[model samples]
Target: MTKLRIGIVGCGSITKYRHAPEYAHNDAVEIVAFCDPNVERATLMAEEYGGKVYADYLEMFHNEELDAVSVCTPNLYHAPISIAAARAGFHVLCEKPMAASEADALRMIAAAKDSGVILMVGHNQRLMPAHQKAKEVLLVGDLGKVLTFRTAFGHPGPESWSADGKESWFFQKDIAIVGAMGDLGVHKADLIRWLLDDEVVEISAFVETLHKEDTEVDDNAICIMRMGKGSIGTLTASWTYYKGEDNSTLLYCENGVIKIGTDPVDQVIVERTDGTIDKYDVGAMSTNTGQTHSGVIDSFIYSILTNTPPAITGEDGMKSLKVILAALESAASKTLVSIH
Candidate 1:
């Protein structure tokens, strides 16, 4: 477990923003290779992150003795790249919206299982300090019972974050698959499932393309989910926030209400039935807002080194993907979809 060798595929905005910088600082990781279809981007990342650049990911995988790889490509490529990495004897840390479809996600899971390599999804919200605390509280039955909840993940649009701006692959439905719902919704799906400690049993949704001109994907989505134990929730993913990012969640229970990433100072706050308030300063999730770290890369490396299971397993990722796909199907058919 001495400085695990790593490779990064698809050197896009996520690589530059989270993976590269985070890996650069981690003492346990050595970024050994970088790959992207764009040679210039791959070369720049290699210069900064101390990795060999390659235009083809398969070539990088063949040449490097990588123990793990981060699949940061478009939604469609997630499955193929992850499956290939798993087969190549490298653990994979794939970005959210694990695949364009559930069938693809299941195939990725099967590949990882068959290859006997770790498969961790980059659902960083579950790694957030506030979120971790919330899960702890809920597991201890402090919330009494999560009867209903509402969570939202939104921002101006990919143009604000994408290196390619509006022309990014994220705007193309053929690649990104489901737009805002795929980009933002899947993260919430994973987080809420973990936080509530429940499975989504049903979904009804409205996945739409209402804003952001010249895009083949949706800009906003509203999904209603019925979870196990009769608990239910609303999930909103949007690229039309226009003003700023809103990655917040509110859980209403029999005894209290939990809020995370909602207020300025109190990052995690609990308000009881008697109006007593408890506030915690657990920091943030990503480096974008105020520089708190995501524990995704760290945990992925730990799992690989220790021969332990990752927090977000391939099956867990598939379950989250199922919710999103079901929502999209529900939107298209105008009916409540049952999660089998």
Candidate 2:
């Protein structure tokens, strides 16, 4: 098959360090264009990635013969660009949290459906080997009836990962919409839902800017979630993890407890009530500085090439976004928010 002509619409740290380089390494993909309001950044990326630079993504979308595009821009621009790309006949690999709001995310999904294009979200946590193995184990009923779960994703701050560091769009409310909740929390929301195969029905949360100074968005969030029928969990996303990155999920089941990403050498561990411990080495989770193939870029390309719906479809993204939006509403209103 011919290489999938690709374009990326953001020159930020994620696009620069993660997305662009991965696409460059994929023999099945060809980087054809780069777009960012920051022309210098786009130009510099184009120089390295072999693409045309554009300050306006709309212009690039219309001009390039792209089979697909990655909407890696600031959170606010996600919906508009993804929608436009769908309408322009390009499959979309939009960076999560799908959009700034539920309405926008829904609109993006509708636009993709109407345009007959595949739309995928960049919730890569689901692609992690440990998480995948955990889901497989859960499906086989090895852990009888998941009772509850507690998951967390926290780091020093986006300043360390943002292309602009402290001044990155991640710290700006207008650009990022919500802070750690949107950035780190959405990943967990997508994760727990995928692992348990249950949607979050309600959420109560505390979203705050506890540590970061002069930030318009929250630096931390702790969410209590009601999943499907009866199972409950707590999701914590924080930018104040000064010690190191902590990304782990603990699922309490009737038969045993399953720990994922909680151990250094052992990535997935199952401790049964029968007094037996099972361990599986599924490799390490990808970090900002880690040099692992995110599987996301490859998966997106495979979906387009194989003419199959992406694993993380637009609707899946919408559901995850709904959870985050509901959590944000709950935090703002100081009440439990229901997801409809």
Candidate 3:
């Protein structure tokens, strides 16, 4: 079997903990190159992963022959790097908040289409066992119509998770674009959209830098969203969740409610209007403190090997990004923003 050659851009905490290890575990992939502006980081990854290090992604693209590339850089670099990789004929698995803007995301989609390569977004929330189970339960129609929902993704901030710690690009408005909203909110947005199989038609939000000091971007955000299917919900993303991580979602339906990521033993809980409850111990969710296999890398590789559309396509990414962008607009205008 000719293994898929992989090139990884940005040797940050995500690459270290998620992308690199996941790719390494896959028998179908061979990581061929690593690129980061911080050459030391690239070098360290290369030493473990058996790849050549480059300070520039373009240089890596020029030097190495790769089948796919993971864009793990800060939010601002996603579009440009993914575009370059796609145009170079490499499949892309870009980190969430696909790009700084919707326009850049569309350009990335265009680049991938023109190059005939897959472009997958790293919205691993959709791949979580509990989330998948929840979607399955919804699809079964046993829960009846989903009326209201609430999803949250919060942690102690990226300072503890990023490679640069306190100096991480996550705090920089120029690089991160939106702090908690981009880092955590986008994941919930993507997850909710996928779970409900509906788009957010309208949104109103309060995005502010509430807790973290010295950050140019927001530390917390609360968004009220109305899905196209008429379901209303709230999405919360916060960096001030200093005690522990909270990645949970609740969907209230006519029948009862479905809760996800709430119980450690039972990751997915379903309650019926008849006052009966069921629990699923699929697995634990991946958190900053307790990392689990995200299943994103394997799915990306499956799409490449099978020549199928990625589970999370660039279009899906763009749609999810639009929600966060709309939330930002709603925050700034102090009014409801509608998604077209």
Candidate 4:
């Protein structure tokens, strides 16, 4: 079997903790190149992954015969980098939020289509055992007729993850565009869209700089959404959680209410009309094993080997990006925004 040669474009925490290590374990992938403006970071990653290092991504694409590449760069670079990779005749697995703007997202999509390369997005949450189980339960009607979705995600900030801590690009509007909404809300939005199997048709939102003493972007945001099927929902994202990660969702339906999140205590809780609450440790069914990278990487490898579309595609990324961007627009304008 010919292993797909992969070139990774960023040497950040995500690349270190997620993509690179996952590809290392996958039998179907051979990471052949790594690039980062910081030579030390690039060199370190290359040494660990047994890949050549390059300071410029363009140079990596020119030198390596890659089958695919992961765009793990910042929001602004995502479109241009992925487009360049697609034109280089390599498939793409870009990090989430797609791009800084809708126009950029569309341009990347066009480039991928023009290049005839598979463009998958790194919405890793979709591959989680808990999320996958929730999707299954909802899709299979186990939750009965879905009525509403209330989701929230908050975790202090990415200071611990970035090289520069609070001084990281995440705190700069020029570099990150927006704060919590861009950094974290995108994932929650994508998950809600996927689990509901519905498009967000309209949105009203507000974003404020409730924290992060030095940043110009909002540290928190709250959004209200109306899905295509008339289901109403609420989404909350913040960089204000004192400690620990919290990404959870609750769905109210005709027959029961389902709750899901990253809780060692409980994953899925279903409340029935009989006044009996059933609890399911959905994480126990995990192929996850507290290892999201492995599961996502395995899925990517399977998709490529089977010549099948990824569970999260560029199109899927764009749809979710639209909602996030629209929320930003709505927050700025202080009005409801149409998502069409």
Best by lDDT: 3
* Regions of candidate 3 where Cα sits further than 4 Å from its true position: none
The window of 10 residues in a row where model 2 has the poorest summed lDDT is 285-294
TM-score winner between candidates 2 and 4: 2
Best of the candidates, TM-score: 3
> Each model's TM-score?
0.97, 0.98, 0.99, 0.95
- Model 4 per-residue lDDT tens digits across residues 1-340: 7889999998987788888999998888899999999989989998888989999999999999999999988888999999999999998989887898889989999998998888888887777777787887777785577788898888778787676687888888886888888877888889888988889999999988997888898899999999998889899988888765678889999888888874566787778766878766756322211335437677777777788998888889999999998998998899999998
Candidate 2 local accuracy as lDDT? 0.91
Per-residue lDDT tens digits for candidate 2, residues 108-192, read: 9999999999999999999989899899888889779889999999999988888899988898998889999899999999999
Each candidate: RMSD to true structure?
1.3, 1.0, 0.6, 2.2
Q: Clashing residue pairs in candidate 2, if any?
A: none
Instruction: Give one digit per residue, the lDDT tens place, for model 1 in 111-169.
Output: 99999999999988898888898887778886699999999999888886888987898
**Candidate 2 stretches greater than 4 Å from native:** none
lDDT at position 122, candidate 4: 83
Q: Which stretches of candidate 4 lie over 4 Å from their true place?
A: 284-291
Better of 1 and 4 by lDDT: 1
Better of 1 and 3 by lDDT: 3
lDDT of 4 at 296: 65
In candidate 3, residue 300 scores what lDDT?
A: 99
Alpha-carbon lDDT, every model: 0.89, 0.91, 0.95, 0.84
TM-score, prediction 4: 0.95
